[model samples]
Target: MTLLLDSEEGARAWIGEAFAPTARQWQQLDRFGAMLVAENARQNLISASTIPTLWVRHIADSAQLLSFDRDNEGLWIDLGSGPGLPGLVVAILCDRPMLLVESRKRRCDFLRAVVAEFDLRHVEVAEAPLERIETRPASTISARAFAPLDKLIGLSTRFSNESTRWLLPKGRNAVKELALLPEAWQRMFHVEQSRTDAESWILVGVGQIGAKQRGK
Candidate 1:
């Protein structure tokens, strides 16, 4: 594979040796700016303003979700996969079947292009709203900057079984969101410092709808 090196020599070197097998993916992520910018110009996906911080805001932010679990089997779903954050990146790094669900046709087209451009075999794009799709229980479900915690959990309920694990990257409101979960839904999380910010965290846990509401 042609090594598409990053402009920052140190980052390029680290990505090459550490992410050796995924070097091509690293290259594609490195070129994210150009692709996003090009797509944004035509009113396709993300806005051009986010391009400046694409590495930290998009790539690294998504990559950190991989630290959540070691299990690679079973389906992994990313909801509201706009511009493919933690979903696409996790799919590339982890050995799991990845499904990216998005309602918009334009974003889905962009996601497909990214998958094709990187020749990513483990990833698939589904063009449908989360509520409308028929999916089996996913071992892992993730979302980033998509919706508030309560709403996300409610929507995720459609695809989660007792065994499903959730990996959500949240900002300052993580703690607040955790507080809102019903008391019966046991949860544990740690505040890991993020690469882009001092207070961000990647939260992971398995939870079931409280027994009182389980039958609903």
Candidate 2:
């Protein structure tokens, strides 16, 4: 795969024909996007300026996280899932069970409302911060613009095991931020250029007992 692409067309090209959403999925996404815009009027969720780029910047950017999960069966835990970017988007698009964890009460309320509005049975939202959350092991974990690589490990280690698949999207400074990681984590991560922006990257990792045991 090319990893990085030129535009939304390039992103669609990269995802290919099979990734097209069903009519129902598209409806849910549309509803969610409209809801986000309406809710933004109530409080700060996403920046108002970015609303014009909502489809590509927020929706497509979030939806692409699932491409890394080939099997598409297993729990997906989205850490600090504010406004449910990939978490809610993924839940809307896929059948896999998912967990969306957000600390803020209003965001959590919005997430729950979205879940109810869509009647999505496979998605669950946790209103606690990652530190306080005691949840089951997840086979896949994702975070977007939430925290740096090192600190994210500290926050999400419990949700992972040797088989967990991580799909963390780090914009622009991915390599630089990745370089700051401890030596042990260097072995486990592979960087993929983002479809939305060439400067961005998605960091993919498979959890290993060795990395965990070594205190990574």
Candidate 3:
């Protein structure tokens, strides 16, 4: 579903939440957007179709992720964090440490540029496949447009713990994917509607997801 851009500016108005960014935060978001726009022309950081609705589709979609963390402490891992999205967005929004995992060298460069530009001390970019990369224990994890639910579980298993929660943005197919997951994982996860897009849903998983592959 294509997101129709509103003239109101910023995603806070559209998200229907009490999200408020200081002037500095908005400026930082603007710089990040500028960097994406500039680099996207050279490397396709984001889809060409999303340029107009970038704020609502990307920034807002990413920003709302922080609301899921009850502790909001420890590290937050963003797997396959293409162009930063929620990982950088969450890092800029709060003071918690964020680990952004990306495989491509170019994307990692772009993320590092943003971190340097913004002086984001809380953000770290890991440039490798999730399986090969050594992952720190994370309090929560997020992935956007990365992989299917089952495959995501397979990749993220190493980073998760007894308390680690998973936040995945499943646009319109949340129900179908939930149905496809193994029965053991059924009890551990639930879906929540996205505040930005009504058609989108955020899948939140608690505890361990796979039973058969336990301790693997």
Candidates in order, TM-scores: namely 0.81, 0.90, 0.90
Give the true-structure RMSD of model 3.
3.2
Tell me the alpha-carbon RMSD of every candidate: 5.1, 2.3, 3.2
Candidate 1: stretches off by over 4 Å: 1-21, 44-49, 186-191, 210-216
Roughly what TM-score does model 1 have, to 2 decimal places? Answer: 0.81
Candidate 3 lDDT by residue in tens digits, 27-133: 89888888888999989778888888788778877877787774658889898999998899888878788899999999999999999989999999999988887
Q: Order of all candidates by lDDT, from best down to worst? A: 2, 3, 1
lDDT of each residue in 111-145, candidate 2, tens digit only: 99999989999998888878888858899999996
- Worst ten-residue run, lDDT, model 2? 9-18
Best by lDDT: 2
User: What C-alpha lDDT values do all the predictions have?
Assistant: 0.70, 0.82, 0.81
Candidate 1 displacement at residue 131 in angstroms: 0.7
Cα lDDT of model 1 by residue, 20-63, tens digit: 64555666666665677787887656556556656655665666
Best-matching candidate per TM-score = 2
